[model samples]
Target: AHIITAVIGSGVLSLAWAIAQLGWAAGPAIMLLFALVIYYTSTLLAECYRSGDPETGKRHYTYMDAVRSYLPGTKVKLCGVIQYANLVGVAIGYTIAASISMRAVRRADCFHYHDVRGRSGKDSCKSSSNPYMIVFGVVQILFSQIPDFDQIWWLSIVAAVMSFTYSTIGLGLGIAQTVANGGIQGSLTGLSVGPGVTSMQKVWRSLQAFGNIAFAYSYSIILIEIQDTVKAPPPSEAKVMKKATGISVATTTVFYMLCGCMGYAAFGDAAPDNLLTGFGFYEPFWLLDVAN
Candidate 1:
């Protein structure tokens, strides 16, 4: 559950759009490569948890603790600063993503009502993401106040369920839409070779896709913290951590492929940054958009 909460989040939603940018072949390949890299790094982090002969007393409970134990001088402080800064950035990013999702839901609801009333000018129901971001940020701040890890078990469970729920909805809608539409959009070419003007531009765009995949697979910063929660002996925690990481990565990879491939197949070049928002006011899809 902890691994699931750590790995699968709003990031999954943009994967299809990322794939669209990278084309079909390179996108899945890059994401799978990221999964491998994440797994490797996670094992390295697990190994860092213990020192000496593994049966010895040394054990680091947090990322900074691990850094301080392993590194010397200013390097420890630098790692600490970078780690916390990354966490802050992640928090802000998630809040902004939640606001975007909320805005998509709002737009879908407005369009649905407009269509039902048979009266539509421009979408008069104007709103900004600021209020939604504030609401999400407040909720996160409240959740952050829970000092005990054990006390947050329910929160982790809830988050894992929500992640699975929305992912399933998004994938189902994509597949359904693809079938109903009877074919894919844009180029059926295997590799999105060059949607850009110049070859150099295409190469740079592909590199950007690689970066997106890397960012999506990054949970290394929290691997130590999650492993610390396992109720096992020092030496055995590595095994526990490996098993948990394997399962989580495997599960998330399947969802990512399904959502990315099906979404790209359905929408192709038209895929939006948020796949749910790209759906517009389409029938039953509006519900999926809202749920996602």
Candidate 2:
């Protein structure tokens, strides 16, 4: 559950745009490659949990501890600072995504009501995403007050379920859109590029897509922290961590493929950065946007 909570997030929503940037063939391949790489790195980190005899002394409870045990002098502090900074960046990114999603949902709801009433409702809500981001940040601050990792097991479980819920909804909507459109928007080869994009620009866009895929798959900074929460016999935490990593990665990969492939099939080069936003304020989509 912890692994799932860490691995799946708002990043999955933009995967279609990433794939659109890379094309169909390269997009899914890159995502699968990222999954494999992350799995390998997670197992490597799991192995670092215990440095000596498991029944004896000295286990690395956190990522910085592992770095400290292996590195010298200021390098240990440097690693700690870097890891925390990466985590903070991840947190900020997610918060911004949540705010954007909330804004989308609100717009969708307003549009839906406008459609039902046969009138425009654009001026109903004048709020921007910053307010929602601030609210989410405050909520995160409250959650952060929980000092113990183990104490948040239930929260992790809830987050995992929510992740699955929204992902399933996205996959289902993608399938529906594909069927309604009678086929994919682009050719089967999926090699199309956005309008006015030059050949050189294509290369840069593909590289950006690669970086986005890498960023989406990155959860190594938290692997050791999650592993530390496992209750197992000495040295067996690696086994538990391996199991969690496999399950989370496998499940998330399926969802990623569905979102990327089906989303591109539906929108082609016009795919938005947030897949859900492209659907607009339609029935059921508004609900899905709310759920997301």
Candidate 3:
């Protein structure tokens, strides 16, 4: 549950756009490469949960603890700064993503409601994300206040379920849209040097795509913390964590492939940066709202 909740984040929503940037050949290849790399590194990090032994040695309660245990002085501080900075960036990104989804839901309803009333373009349905961001912030604060959140067994489970819910919805919608398009879209080389995109822009976007795929598979920063929650000895915390990491990475990789490929097939080169909230499929507003 912890692995699932951590692995499948808002980063998955960008995969289609990433794929579009990299093209048919390089996209899936890079994704699989990232999956392999992440899984391997995660296992290594999982093994680092304990200082000297797999089963009995002193436990490193946190990532910083593990760093301090092995790489003594300055490296620990550097790791701490990098790790927390990444967390802060992730928080901001998620907040923005939540606000975008909220705005999308409202805009979807606005478009639908107007269409039903025989109105077209009368209202652009644009709205500020400030209120929505504030709402998400409040909700996050409430959740954070829960005592011993990491030990709350059901919290990760609920989060895992919600993550799967929206992910599956996005995948289903992508598949449906692809079928509706009558044929497969996209090329082996992806977006060509056309009128809108320059050669330099292609290079930049391709590099960004690598980062996007990497971001989707990144859960290593929390691997030690998750490992700390495992029950003792018999199987060993390292063993359990490795198993969990493998399963989670494999599961997420499958979902990422399906979502990314189907979305790219559905929208071709013009795939939006976000599959669900990017107005890729405006119809079935209720479903869009639910997914968001």
* Clashes by residue pair, model 1: none
Clashes of each: 0, 0, 0
Q: Candidate 2: misplaced stretches above 4 Å?
A: 54-57, 121-127, 146-150, 187-195, 278-281
CA lDDT of 140 in candidate 3? 98
User: Which residue pairs in candidate 3 collide?
Assistant: none
Q: Comparing 2 and 3 by lDDT, which wins?
A: 3
lDDT of 2 by residue, 76-193 (tens): 8888889989988998888988887788788777776777788965678445899999999999889778777457559889988998787667666777777888988754434454
User: Candidate 2, residue 48: CA error in Å?
Assistant: 0.6
Over 46-70, each residue of candidate 1 has an lDDT whose tens digit, in order, gives 8887776554548788888888888
Best by lDDT: 3
Candidate 1: residue 260 lDDT (0-100): 84
For each candidate in turn, the TM-score is 0.90, 0.91, 0.97
Name the best candidate (by TM-score).
Answer: 3
Scanning candidate 3 in windows of ten residues, the lowest lDDT window is 118-127
Model 3, range 1-292, lDDT digits (tens) per residue?
9999999998888899999998899999999999999999998998889877788899998999999988978898999999999999889989999999999999999999898998888368989999999999999999899888778889899999989988888899898999999988999999899899999999999999999999888789988988988999988999988898888999999999999999999999999999888989888999999889
